[model samples]
Target: MTRRGATRNGLTRRGVPAVLLDVLLVLVALADTWANVDLGQQPAVSCALLGSFALLLRRRLPLTTFLLTVPTAMVSDAVFATLAALYTLASLSRHRVLLACCALTYAIIDFLPWPWSTLRANELSGTHNVVHLIYAVATAAAPVFLGQLVQARRELSLRLTEITEAREHERLLTAQGVLARERAQLAREMHDVVSHQVSLIAVQAGALQVSSQDPEAKRGAAAIRRLSVQTLDELRHMVSVLRASGSRPTELTPQPSLADLQRLVDGSGMEAELKTDLPEGLSPPVQRAVYRTVQEALTNVRKHAPGATATVRLHHVNGRVEVTVTNTAPTRPPLPLPGAHHGLLGLRQRAELLGGTVTAGPTPDGGYELHLDLPREGAG
Candidate 1:
């Protein structure tokens, strides 16, 4: 491949017009022949023309054209074709450095003792020969230096382009990371403000209902307690959907369902019972809402009604699914702690979006109850 590339480049168009250089070489041949060749020596004239005209083929056949000029160059004063061919050969040919060294030596030897030059071998001083040698070496180095610069520039430009593309890719990935974190922050903020308040209300109402003596006051307290508890439950389900990692299918495996409620209770590290008269294969949306409703209700029970037993029930009645989760009265007040109640509003949004309704209030026996209704079709 390297050899092929060198061959291809040898034939490529030049910055200095190739045809004009060829003509200049030919003119040098004519000038030298007129000045030095005797009228009878037509053979010497023919050899000079052969060397100069060979420049037309220098690019197309760089090495071959250079060899063609060597014999003619040793005898004739005209050596432009020889010099031009050496330049192309050094620049575009394979083994460029090695070839340049060899050609430099050849140029000095070929030009130094040429028969047509003014200084003959017998009269040539050591100083004069050194000067001639320097001239030849300089001539050879010029073209080789120009070609090396062109190759260097081409390689540098290509490397710069690669670096630019890599930087753009890195920037794109960084921008995406920033955007994802910003979205997750928004989800967290909503949960903090809403979930904390609803959970707080539910816990307080339960205590108030148990403490109240008047029938009216007790009933009012029960209603408030149930609503708050149920609101808290709904929010958990809604927020869970958002909080699950949607970016990966593996992370989004099926959520807890009606059958899975027992498992949820067992793993909850709390005392709870689950009962269901509901059939299997509920639509995913309804199932998720139902599971979340029950899950959140039980969570609130654990949080506020310590030592309370939560009872979960599922019913399929009148083309609808009904889920009820209730807890016994708390033996002790809940721990006073800061909370993020952000999930309450999110729960309402979940039920409404799925065409379902959920409610929570105090039970008659100084406890709390949460109920949710979703239609058989698309959660009604």
Candidate 2:
């Protein structure tokens, strides 16, 4: 059972509230006192009463309470108060020597008669007195044994609860380890099978486009090559994301940086110009965000604004990096293309993570412009 459930069950088994239990013990002690001690014996009666009431302090000061009840046990026949105090002390205390001494003290006190100088030696030698002394020792040891058993049970329950929780945590970690391994295996398959085939398709398309005589055939081959290349790029990104799952943040394969920006623009198969005058030594995240923003903007322009020229500019100003991609009006209508439409949304999210922003809108001259601004420190 859960720890909370066990605690609730313990409370249910107890049945009586602590205050009521204390009151009940006090009443039992008082009844024992009245039955054992005579009213006329003033000193014995007073000690009996004091010990009976002292049961109320057993939970808080068990040793002191046990000591207080010793006087009554010695002077009168009343024993309920002393037994209760002894049991409480045994349950709460860990010192074997202390408990042993307390039990021995109780046994001696209960066995010896009052006014010890009167007839002690002769009485102790009698068979009846010897049996009575044995009975008193047995009674004292009873409570101590019972109290120690109760303490051991309580500790065992807590230890079981800790073991249960540790096993549950281990089970969760094992499940996650299995999932991470599966993802890694899937990533390797995609890279080896799907990416390799797409690369071959792009290469074949490039060869066909170069060798074709008909303009229409060449255009078709070029389109096929470009689309294949784009698909390969997307497949690589997806594989990287998959491999990164359940792991620490890592650099994506073919990790993009500002140095790759020129190659990206040149390979985009569009009339695009790149201009940058930014400082060196930018953080990786900042450079990556800039590269992805330019890549996405150039892709959109190629797909949606055919025959339009694009200008890419980047610079640093006021401790911030700024990037803008602007494209003129399309000379021909854009062809229908299938897209998940998450490119700009993803760019914005990446920018936000680096304390940056991405904004896109139409310019006054019937052109589209995309802008990205990032802090130089990159979310430090």
Backbone clashes in candidate 2 total 0
Summarize candidate 1's per-residue lDDT along 1-380 as a digit string, tens digits.
Answer: 44422433333334555466567776876676577556566776777677777777766687887887776667766666666677767656657666767577566656566555576657556787778877777776777777666656656766898999999999988887777676567558658978898878888888888988987677657767766775777676655555553364223344666677777777554568888888877887888888788777876887788778888888999988888888999988987766586454556677878777778889899899988877866534
Best-performing candidate as measured by TM-score = 2
- Provide the TM-score for each candidate, comma-separated: 0.38, 0.59
**lDDT assessment of candidate 2:** 0.88
TM-score of model 2 vs. true structure: 0.59
Error of 1 at 230 (Å): 21
Each model's C-alpha lDDT?
0.72, 0.88
Which pairs clash inside model 2?
none
- For model 1, the superposed segments whose C-alpha errors exceed 4 Å read 1-61, 93-97, 115-126, 183-380
